[model samples]
Target: MKNNTYYRLTLLAVILSLSVTAATFGQGRQNRLTNSPREGYWVIESQPRQKSVALFYNDDNQLIYKEVLSKKRLNIKQAKTQESLKAVLEQALRQWAVSQKTGGNPIQNDQQWLAAELN
Candidate 1:
């Protein structure tokens, strides 16, 4: 009887641990930006110490631009043109919004803007 009880307790503990871990993982993803409208210009506020990447898109869902605004160096090798810069800015803004909702510190600098201009 004692062995059976011990086994059951162990199983319960394992189940509880798994549940807690799953919950945390879900929360982490929720903290990041997910599916959001890829239209217009967005303003992104990133953590003072981290680099931010924003993405901009046109009405047809084409990747028009991308930008990486960072306090540190951001190695963007494929970004060219204003469109690409706009795409990057939009994505960064979405991420910043999500981060803010999830308890991340507000962006300290107000220098980032992502605009998706129609061409």
Candidate 2:
């Protein structure tokens, strides 16, 4: 019973958070992204001193990929604009690519490494 209550509360928090986040963007045409219309529904959740989580869902509402952008993990700034958001996603993908090459060890959040990759 206690475990079930915990789960319910957690679920409620997520729903409420998502609702508030969605409301921030407004309705109808305002909700849609002009930069990447082909990508489908994308949800972004960001909070103070925590990792920014971006969830990309397909047209069928299936999650395609979820990226966690962390200052601690990648030293990246908060994604405030469309370009920055794309850069964060690209950084996450780049980390995945590097992991594939290096047998899955997590990469350090180094500015120098990121700068080299960008160049």
Q: Across residues 2-71, which tens digit of lDDT does each residue of candidate 1 receive? A: 9999999999999999999999999887754353344555333355588665544445454334455655
Candidate 1 achieves a global lDDT of 0.54
Q: What lDDT score belongs to each candidate, Candidate 1 first?
A: 0.54, 0.56
* Residue range 1-119, candidate 2, lDDT tens digits: 99999999999999999998888767644645444444345566777777666664545675545656664233235444454545544555555457758897654432332233333
State which candidate has the highest lDDT: 2
Model 2 segments beyond 4 Å from truth? 1-35, 72-80, 84-119
Lowest lDDT 10-mer window, candidate 1? 110-119
RMSD per prediction, one decimal? 13.7, 16.5
